[model samples]
Target chain A: MSRAYNFCAGPATLPEPVLQQAREEMLDWRGTGMSVMEMSHRGDEFVEIAETAEKDLRKLAGISDDYAVLFMQGGASSQFATIPLNLLGDKTSADYVNTGIWSKKAIAEAGRYAQVNVVASSEAEGFTSIPDQESWDASADAAYLHYTPNETIGGLEFDFVPETGSVPLVADMSSTLLSRPLDVSRFGLIYAGAQKNIGPSGLVVVIIHRDLLGKARKITPTMMNYQVFADNDSMFNTPATYSWYLAGLVFKWLKGQGGVEVMGEINRRKASKLYGFIDQNDFYANPISPRFRSWMNVPFTLADDALNNAFLEGANERGLLNLKGHRSVGGMRASIYNAMPEAGVDALIDYMTVFAKERG
Target chain B: MSRAYNFCAGPATLPEPVLQQAREEMLDWRGTGMSVMEMSHRGDEFVEIAETAEKDLRKLAGISDDYAVLFMQGGASSQFATIPLNLLGDKTSADYVNTGIWSKKAIAEAGRYAQVNVVASSEAEGFTSIPDQESWDASADAAYLHYTPNETIGGLEFDFVPETGSVPLVADMSSTLLSRPLDVSRFGLIYAGAQKNIGPSGLVVVIIHRDLLGKARKITPTMMNYQVFADNDSMFNTPATYSWYLAGLVFKWLKGQGGVEVMGEINRRKASKLYGFIDQNDFYANPISPRFRSWMNVPFTLADDALNNAFLEGANERGLLNLKGHRSVGGMRASIYNAMPEAGVDALIDYMTVFAKERG
Candidate 1:
């Protein structure tokens, strides 16, 4: 079947091999005579699937014994509320470093649960760059310091992990997870919605320090309590089994592609190629600072806004789909996630160059 | 491929045709060159799928303009908390009729939000029958009266809708929805988790009276508020798109089979056939009162407990699976939902009769 290079921000493009395997197994998964969707989450078959997915994710993220991996729903947005609900115990305040749209959303949701202190914000500069770490004024007794490593909307990312001293540091790594290697021990928690880099949309992978469990407020639902999920092994309730299964397949695919380390180099190469083309061409511009430009989502605009429709329409006709930018910041966003091969990015760059020459 | 007649109470057996269609469409859904899982929920293609699903569900349920149908996540368990969060506005007390395990859970969760009044309970009666409506002590000024139309574990179902007079009646129809036809106007609200009779485990269907949309507690999450989902047309956040798509197919299949009215008749016949066989055999027994026995989940046991393992082993050898009852109430349960055809139930009865004769 002919396929397109889909650049959707989320519910995004997935590995072709994973989709093929899922199709092959859809009717009778591994000879179980039932679809994965029909298997009881409590059944041994599904339990094994869930356990292996968690194990694979731990391996991929290089998670250690001190961290508990949780598979949850409601995406990264839900974690905006859950992070504070689970961590902000007696402390009435927490520090948040806002890089772009996702971090701001996290701060907004955290405000409902705790006193949100904006330790540093790039919004003053139109979210095109991350503020220097020295500029942050983190509270001494704050519950935790939170930030987003990669903002999907503005295509800005942080190159270094912030040091929070003895306090826990949490990062919403939704868009950049598995794109490169990182020291998992550096942060107290890392949560990622699985649409872009992992597998599917419904599952959110959260790696939290063991010490952060069991401090939820009295009003917290059992489903949202970190301890409840950790104790139950992320089976506090019936999970999104199909998504979990697909995530496992993606994990296996990642392992086959020489794991995250090799994939990181490929990702960097692909990002540099696309970014180089944009920077070299006067007809195209990417406003994000060079040091903080995201490796996954690259938001760029034509020098002439009138050509936006032409670019998208021409790209669609050529089978590059979902290139429209977020309504909050519009132009175009080419999300080159892990599943997106270097060939796909090269194809996109070729199209962008051709469009620029024709319209310039 | 050989398959088993899985009798799991939930995450239960799905129709073979549904599975077949899903398999065929897994790689390229309707010639879109991508699986439904790979599509963006906000895309026009997915929007069409979501709208068609909602429209078909409304047709199957015979829902009217007075009510709004919502496709939500977190299952019925989530709704246990969401109901009180949404309905307990300005009211301190809500009446609960505790019929079985599910109602008890709903009551426990609701207690976190408001004062719960147990109007009637069948725990004293071993949860074998629904308490007579006259025995209820419903509060005159309560926000709503909540009940479970079917108790899956205990296998008791309300044969008649309770009259709430001026007060609104709410029903958790997770196990009984689509098994029968009912007057949509009878209840103020109804919610069903999709695993049993719909498509998958992750999606939950909620139908609420139009007037019940906006009165939520201050602490209610925007995701849990019915009015928010209503306003966004259940796209307030990324929904479980593939599950929603399969549910739409299930609705179409139901329509082709004469919709829920005919499905109700088929369900009753299937239940009676199995129940009749069990009642006639001395070795087999169903403890539920005949008048209140659920058509969806039928719980039963052998005259001797020692034969339980042997019965299950023999059944499995003959392609019967997941017949083990819930751990809370041990024995066996056959959840013959709308997906379980008459032939499967007939095969089950034949196997039971053969096993019973040999055991005796």
Candidate 2:
């Protein structure tokens, strides 16, 4: 049987080459005589893998020395709590942009640690648009400005990075970190769960400005302290070693695919074709506004809701899998991250057209 | 090349069959046309895997419905902070028995959240022995009594379960979870890092008595709340999906090896031979007291400290690998987890005898 085009929002699609490499190295990593999963994270062999992964990620994103790329455990959801704990030093409040599902979750978690001042919200309109920055009532007294660049569940994304003048701009890029080239200088810290554009779940990649360290609240757990992790090089405890190694393999694969700039072009093309068909057809429509529709996650609904099940069944039969949207908002979402190939998108488009014609 | 024995603490060793099965299923899991890594956690197939894994684990440990088995991220170290945050509800303090590195860490983390009562400490003895429970000064008003049943780094294992009276007993069983049969009803909560005896790193298994739920502090992060995890069936957020799947496979493998009791006998035999050789020989030594020494982790020192590097080199040459002890307390450690075959232990013993003779 041929491989399916996996459309999971996360634990999503990975490059075939990456999967193949992992398979070949499952028993022995580069003749080290042990599975990479079995090697100690502190061992020289894995250390080299770790260092090289960080180096490659730095090169791919053009990250500077001021940013510490720490490989950590717990997904981006954990970071929602950690960010506020680490950044809400003397300030009693933090500014948040309520864009969609992820931003709302982050805002809710932040409320536990600090006073949340929601500067902007798209909730009034079913989160179909990103509120313009000029209208946002962001706070100067806030410790940091937090937002989600791409909301995976609602399939809404901001086209431009928010400018936060003097305050630190912290963004959760879990859904869109390496789908394209991102400028590291514009943000104080950036974090992403690795399951999407990266390797697998369990490992989170954090890129933070070195100066942001050492301001955690007294009640913060050591594992949640950014300064502690930076001091120990993310080895404050045993990390997700297998996931880290697989991420290294993914970094190498990304580099081999002509880097993120190339990946950006490929991702753009894949998302373009899928979204294009959705927009062009009368039977299919993406709910989110054009400006806020995500390039990574394309969620669309059929003109007739009754055909939803039939559409999904046909899609599954055609090997287009995990196309269901988040249950919070019903429809279908195709998350075509960096790992998704153009052919996968083409296949989806062809299937959509055929299915529409047959049911029209 | 033949597979070498991996003796480093963890991400230590895994069953070869598990690795082989993962490799074979790497690309297309069960004709699903996508690797298990690529499947959405909520998808029917991955959901089945998670359910089966949870059921298998419960059966292997003889865990009753009264306990919730949670598959969490952030290894056992994170639990050092989470346990106190979740369990220390109304009580201002918790009881701790400091045996070695892991216990001290747990105790220290608890202090950040609650007042700590050090009931008994073996630190004065260089962590070479477990203090007798009769000398303990436990607090009746404490939230819970936490201890390290098996200290991986110090090679100490409790010979008897400490009776906590009405107080709950929590343990960091990272290194010793499935190496033998455990009576789940004997403890209130037990958590283990998956890299050892389980499948891989990044996943922590927690078995908590059901009554312990719903009492998290107001300040606790949602992800840190045991009630949140238990209520959500350990899917509060995107879990470590791959590790969860692999852990399910490891559970199946353990069952095939005749469950925990059979593995317990094999483990006892393996530890007996290695400790037997070290105990009978004058050329080597195990520093920890005999009764308290771990049956899973055996730490031994050469007669001459100068030959530590030489012994490791010889062992590596003979495909006996990762035999070096932890740098925190350097010498040699052979971690014979469920995955380490009896032959691997025999090989290590033969290499040790040959090396000692050569250096003698």
Candidate 3:
């Protein structure tokens, strides 16, 4: 098999050119005679790599100097705790809009530290649709408003950023970041796990408004404290250097492909092609509300439950790999991230067409 | 330059064969048609990779079933807080031995969660020697006794593991683990950042006795809880997948070199050759107590500090790299971990001899 379409949600597929460049430099990064993994975090070479990555990301995301972008470890799940630890200054509560599984996880973890106010929830609707912002029962004393911009498991996404006004807005953008242009100023903080659209597992990129710093609770582990990371340029300890370097390569590739604006256009087309097919076919159906459907993850179900395995098996046979849905959510999900070329989606749609005709 | 000897403490040099194998598999791992970086953490391929690495490490380190080996992130610095959070169940204070920078750091971080009792310290002695275990003021009510087996910056090492009777003994073996064979039964938990003798920088290998799990404080982040990781098989969150895979490759390479016993012999010889040259040469001197000299990191100084830059430049021209000492302790240091070949150490000795002859 020659680089089958990997749609594993995350640890998702990376660009082929990025992988090729990484391979070429694995033994000797340029003429350094050492792999980037072997470079010191404090050394000039790695510092340059780390800086270039942050700069490229800022340029791509349109992040301003008012925000400090941190290259951190332990993924977005770690940030679920980190955000509340660093943001809940003297407030007794924080508002959360529960859209799906990822949102609930954040709410549960934040509950350990502060009073969690569920302003709105789509769980009552089986997480297939986003609750209208007008229906929110927000807290006046809340420190921040938190929401999941894209839920990877349930294929649900928020169509609008909540208007938090004075309260800071925080978003878990793990599956959607770098897939399109984003308004960095709309949120007080935006964190995304690198595996999906960024680079690899274990690295999370955090863009935080500088004013949010210096508010960490006393019990917060220094490693999880945003200010400590901000002060050290995210090199307070030995960071995941290799992963950081790879992310820089990804940013370079994204630039070469004309930035996130271009990626946004391509991704919307890919998602539309697959979702369009799902709606037109009687044998397949997607449960997400059309308005709240994710452009990165498309979850669909077969008309007959028994044919699901056959659908997946046949898809794999055609080199469309990892089309299996998340274990928590039953049917099938196709995650078309930034690296998923339009060709991969075309192949998947072709396979789906053949399978539906044979099994319908 | 073609793969010069990297002597910075860590993210240190990895075995050439391990890097080569990783390079070959960077794009498509073992016919999976996806890089290991792109694999789902819960997928069969990555699960197999994760399990095999743990098994091989257990075999090499002689870890038993009573110990749950965890592949963790955030390096050893995170563990400085994690150890106290998990181990100080009902106890107020934990015993600590501060021999060098790393031990002091552990003590400082542990201070946040527990009443840290400095049982013994070599700080007054300039961290040149380890205080005898008999001199330690062991606390009867202490939760655990912690020590650094090797300090990368200070170039100090403990020749003997301290006896704390029934108190669980924890060792930060970040710079020394797997450089030699060890008695796993002597430790309650042994954690090492993987940049040194292991494969990469982002991953940390932890060998913790099962009895030590489930004691985390109420305020502990779920990501920091050892039991959560143990129960979830370290997939409680997405781990550093690529680093874990690279570590597995290094473990396989170590096995081919006849395991830790062979590595131990080679490491000893490498340390001896370098130290012997420094001692014999008048223009160079190593300040460590003879018995306490690190087998992994050798920090030395020139008789005239003025000649330091010239010495490093000459060595770099000969394809020897990263030999500069830590800024906190200015001089020259060569880190010879398990991956640093005996020939590299020999090359360093030859360069040191010539530098002495030229500048004496």
Candidate 4:
């Protein structure tokens, strides 16, 4: 079967090799006589699978001993509520920097449990830029400061990490995670939805500093409480085992491709190639400031809105799928995650060039 | 490859045919040129898959138009929190019947969002029996009455539905769901984690009465709000597509096997045969009261505790695996869900009889 370059923002493109290996092992994983899906979470086989995944993920992210890595379910959207529920102990408030849709969502979920102080927001600037760190109005006794490093919809990214001093810094790194190297020590907590740059949709990776545990409210569900999950090894209940197994395969693939540092270089090159095309062409425009342009999701609009249909149609014909931008921000978006080969970006660029010539 | 009859309480056995089909379709589903995992949740192909799954699931459960069927993430564990958050709007309290581990968990999570009144409890009976529904002390002004129809851990089940009059009844049917037929109209809400009698662990099936909509607390996550899931057709976020798709396939398989009515008869016969073997011999015994013994999960123990390892080893030698009981209450458990063919039960019986003959 000829596979198309899937650009649809996640449940997105996975490495073909991972899919092939999954197919090969679908019936019998390591001759275990059962697919990973059928394994009990407590079984030795699955325990090893979960451990390997956490270990590989830790290695890839350069995580330190001070952090606990958790493989959770319900995606990053769940973390929006979970982070605040687990962290907002006795504290009635937290600081949140609203960079884009994701950060806004985190803030909204946090609002359920705590009083939210909008530290800074890029909405007034159409979410095309990240607010300067100096503009943030952090709360003195806030439980934590939350932010999204990359907004998948607005294609805005933070070029530098924010310093929270004594206050813990939390980030929803769903889009930018695994695309580059990260300084794990800088954040008190980091959570990412696995679909975009990691592995699958159901599993979420959360990296939390060890001290963040045991603060969850009495009412927090065992599954949602970070300490319960950490103590139970994220197997407090049955985990999304198949998704976790697939993520391990993806981690192995990342290791084979020379780890995250090498992946960062490749991602940088691919983003530069595609962004270079958009910047040079008057017919197409990515409004995000160059310094803060996202390396993962690149959202661009055509000079003429009428040409949008024609552009998407042509791209589809060339097997460039899922390029439609988020409905909230109408335009085009190509999410070039770690699994997206440079060739896919080159193909996208070639299509963009051809589409520009015809529409210009 | 030699296959073992996995008696895991959950993330349990699937029909061999379903596993084979999933394996065959792993790389490309119906020549769609993409793995179902790779398909965008909003794409036409995945939408069709999702719709068909919902339709087939509705048919299998005999769900009517008055109840909205929602596919959600976070297993039954999440629903423990979401249910109270949604149903207990202005109400300060709800009635819960603690039947086993799952019900206790549900009660604990609900307590976070509302005042949970334990109307009945089987824990004092060692969780081996379900309290008579007539003896329950349900509050008149409580928002709803909650119970677990079948507890996976203790293998206790309610044989009769409780009478709640105009009060809504919510059942977490995770283990026994679709193993038998039920009058759907009798309950206000029913939810099942898909790992047991359904398909996979990541996806949950929530059936809520139409009248229950719009009652969620303001802070409920959009993904957790049943109304939002109902309104968006469970596409409020990117769902666990592969799990959802597999569940649909299982629903179709169940339909092919003469639907829930016929399947229920088969399940009853299978449970009776296995339970009969254990009861007839003093060496093997199931502690659950006959009426409350779960048809889905049958937890039993040997007359000798020291023989546990030998029993499991001998069982594994004969291709019966995961027979060891849950660590919480150890001995042995044989979860014979709808997917476990009668032959598998016979095999387990034969193995047990042989082991008893040798040990006795």
Candidate 5:
């Protein structure tokens, strides 16, 4: 296969133009006579690259000067501990909504440092729906309210941001960021692992309001402390330079495609078409509530579990790949991110239509 | 210029062949129809790539089964904290040697967690030479004895591994790990940032004895805990896939060039010729004692400080890039790591000779 519609969730598909530019510049970046990876981070070339990347990211996301953007490493998992270590300064506990696996993981890591108040939980409902915000057990004394706007594995997404006035709202927007327009002021912090929608696996982008910068616990590792990065412009130590460069390419690609507003409309169409196909076909079904379905990742089950392998094998016979669902979830998931072309989603739906007819 | 001799300390030069292979496979890795960055980290293709890289690193470094090799994120700076967090279980103190800037940084970060005992320091001598081991005051109750085998900025290297009887030895070999053959059995843990001799930045390769695993403190982030990565084979979260792949290519390139013994001989010649030229020329001077001089990073000064920019500009025109030394130490540094060809060293020497003849 030359090039397939990759649905591996993450490290997921990247825009073809980004990959092409990266390949063209792999050995020599703009006549510098060195690959971006080979250039010193402190050098003029990489510094400009880093600065331009940050500037472009701020422009595309409508990030205000009130926020400090950090290009960090160790992915979103590291942020689980880092968030509490930094944010829970004088506070004893933090409020978290257990929407799915990602939210639960964040909650579990935060539990080690602070008393975690479960504001709302959909785990009891097999993570098929997001609990209503009105029913949430509000905590006035909590440092912040944390939630996953979109859960990749569970294929569940929140219809609206929770109302957490005065109390900061933090989100693990790993799978949802850059997919559409976002109000940056709505959250105290937004962290997204770059593999899905950004560029690559090793990098995680953190956009935190400046007020949340200081207050890291003394025990927090210097690299994990947000203030340290904020002070140094994310170069307190050597950052993931290549991953950061690739991410910059991705941000450029996003801007060229008319930024998030245009992406939001296209992504909506892609998700609705696939979800519509799954609903109309008797042989296929998605478990998530309609209002809570994710635009990025669409998970569905066939009429029989025995046909899963055959279904995947046939998909691979065509140019579709990594359609298998998460190991914990034993069905299929098609993650159509910003990079996943609408044609890819259409091809997937067409394949599903044929498969349901043949295997029904 | 198509390509130049990149003398950056790190994100340093990578072998031409490795970069070539990466460029060719950037669009689709082999027949997978997806870039390595696009593959699921748990997928068969990436897992194999990850495992093969580990296997090659182990074979090249002569690592035994007693060690767990981890491909981690956040570079060597993260390990400065991770080493103490994971190793300082019940022990109140750890022993350290202060060789140069890198060692001082490791010591500073470790101070956040434990009683850091500076066993010996060459700072009094301006980091020109390693302190003699016989004068060292190591602690019997120390959790571990740590040292930097090579100080990248100061251009200092240990001629011998510190002898710690029962105490496990830890080494930051970020600039010197695969430059030659190593006795992996000698250390409790060894870590090198991938930017230097490995592949790219944002990835750190850790080799640790199995006995060092399972001793992480309660406060240690799961990502920082050696045991978690050892258990999951470093895929607890998404690893740096693209960097790891490039590293595998570097390892393969090393093997093709006749393994570490051959590299050791070549690296020795590369360093010797550059150092020899500097010593013989009155216009150039390397400050470190000849015995303690680094084989990877050779920091030198000019006859006059005023001519520094002229020297650098001239070198740049000759397609010799990043020869400017660390800002803290205002001179010239030619970091001739394994990827830096002997020919690059020759070219640097040639450029220096012409500049010296004009100005001497």
Candidate 6:
């Protein structure tokens, strides 16, 4: 079957091989005579899938025994409330950096649970860049410091990890997980919505330090409590089994493509190719600063605004789809997540070049 | 594919046609050139899938426009906490009927958010039967009357809906939703985890009256708020898209099977055939009262305790899988959900009769 180069930001593109395998296994998974959707989460078949996926993810991220990786539901937007509900231990305040929409949402949710201290914010400059660590004024008594590693909407990303001193560092990595290798020990908790780089939309993956467990507030729902999830190994209730299985397939695919390190180099190359092309052409331009521009999500706009609709229409005709930016940010965004091939970026550049030449 | 009669409580058996169709559409849904898993929830393709699923579910359940249907995540267990968080508006207490494990769980979680008055409980008799509604002393000032219409683990079901006077009646139809037809107007709210009769494991369907909207507590998470979900058309966050899509397929298939009314007749026949066989044979017995016995989940115990493992092993050899009962209630359970064919039940009865004759 012919496939299009899809650039949806989250609930985004997945490897064609994974999709094909899922299709082949939809009726009967490996002679189990049941689809993964129909298998009990507690069943041996699904348990192995869940455990192997966890192990593969731990290996890919180089997560140690010191951290517990939780496969949860409700996505990262739910984690905005869940993080504070699980992590705040006697501390009434937490520090947050407002880099873009994601961080802003997290901060707002955390405020409902604790006192939110905005250590740094780039809202004044339209969230184009992550504020420098030296400019941050983190509270010494704060329970944790939260930030969005990559914001899908504005295409802003932090190039460096924040220094939180003794405070636990939390990150919403929804847009950039598994695109590169990173030290999992640097952050106390890392949560991601599994729609961008991961497999599907329903599941969220959370990696929390073992030390951070068992601190959930009394009001936290049983499903929202990370401590309860850790104790039960994320099976406090029936998990998003099929989504978790699909994520396992994605993890297996990533491992086959040579772990996160090799994927990181390829991702960097893809990002540079597209950004380099945009820089060389005056007709197209990216708004975010080069230092903070997201490698996974590239937001751009045509110099001639009137040609935008025609460009997207023509791109659709060429089998390039969902290049529209977030409605909150009116522009074009090509989310080149880990699953996206470098050839997709090359094709986008080729199509953009033709569209500009025809319209300019 | 060589299929087996799967008796797992949940994620339970699904229609073979649904699984086959899912496989066909796994790669390219209606020639969209993108898998349903990859589509953006906000994109037109997925939006239509979500809307159609909701509409089909509303039609199948005979839900009125006066009620809102919410497709949510985290399962029915999460709703145990979320129900009180969303509905305990201006009231300190709510009435709950504890029929079995599911009821106890919901009561425990709701206690974290409100004053739970368990007006009726069958736990003293080891949750073998549903308590009679006439024995229930529901509080007139209570926010809502909560009960599990069918308990999966204990195989207990309410023969009649409880009369709550002014209090809104809320039912957890998790184990039995869409297996039968009922008047939607009788209950203020009805919720079911999709793992049973609906579709998959991750998604939960909540049908709530229009009057119940905008009543969430201050501490309710944005993702957990009913009004937020209803107002946003259940897209308050990235929903369980694939699960929702599969549910739509199930709903479509149910409609093709002449809706819930036809399904209910077939289900009653399947249940009666199995129950009739068990009741007529002295070697097998079901403990629950006949009136309260769950039609979807038929839990039966062998007369001799020594033969339990041997019986399961023999059943497995005969292609009956996951028939072992929930550990909380040790016995054999055949979860003949809406998807379980009458032939599967016949096969199970055939296997059981042979086992009894061989070992008698």
Task: Give lDDT: candidate 4, residue A199.
Answer: 80
Where in model 4 is the C-alpha error above 4 Å?
none
| Full-model lDDT, candidate 1 | 0.88
**Predicted model with the maximum lDDT:** 5
Tens-digit lDDT track of model 6 for A135-233:
889899999999898988888888998888799999988887899999889999999999888888889999999999999999999999888898898
Query: Tens-digit lDDT track for model 1 on A1-360?
Result: 467888888888899999889888877778777788888899999999998988888898799989999888777877888888889889899999988878888888888888999999999899999888898899999999999898998999888999899889999988888888989999988998888888777678899999988899887877777898899888877777888899999999998998889999999999999999999999889999999999999999989899899999999888788889999999999999998889889899889889888888
Question: What is candidate 3's lDDT per residue for B1-360, written digit by digit as tens?
Answer: 699999989899999999999999989999989999999899999999999999999898899999999988999999998999999999899999998888888988999889999999999989999988888899989999999999999999999888888999999999888889899999999999999988788888889999999999988989889999999999998999999999999999999999999999999999999889889888889999999999999999999999889999999899899999998899999999999999999888888888888787
lDDT of 4 by residue, B1-360 (tens): 566788888898898788888888876778766788888888899999999988998888889999999988888888988999899978899999998888888887888888999999978888878777778898999999999888888889899999999889999988888999999999999999999888988888999999999998886766788898889998877788889989988988898999999999999999999999999999988889898888998988999999999999998778788999999999999999998899999999998898899997
Using DockQ as the yardstick, the better of models 4 and 5 is 5
Each prediction's whole-model lDDT (CA): 0.88, 0.90, 0.92, 0.88, 0.94, 0.90
lDDT of 5 by residue, A305-341 (tens): 9999999999998889999999998899999999999
Evaluate residue A349 in candidate 4 and report its C-alpha lDDT on the 0 to 100 scale: 89
Residue A156 lDDT (model 2): 91
Model 5 - which docking category? high
State the lDDT of candidate 4 residue by residue for A216-320, as single tens digits.
886676678899888899888888988999999999999999999999999999999988998899889999999999999999999998888888889888878
Which digits, one per residue and each the tens of the lDDT, describe model 3 over residues A148-168? 999999999877888988899
Task: Highest DockQ: give the candidate number.
Answer: 5
Each candidate's interface RMSD (Å, one decimal) is 1.6, 0.8, 0.7, 1.7, 0.6, 1.2
For TM-score, candidate 2 versus 3, the one ahead is 3
In model 2, the clashing pairs are: none
DockQ, candidate 4, comes to 0.61
When 2 and 5 are scored with DockQ, the better candidate is 5
Provide the global lDDT of candidate 6 against the true structure: 0.90
Candidate 2 to truth, TM: 0.99
TM-score: model 4, chain A? 0.98
Shift of residue B74 alpha carbon in model 6, Å = 0.6
lDDT tens per residue, model 6, B203-292? 999999989889999899999999989999999888988999999999999999999999999999999999899999999999988888
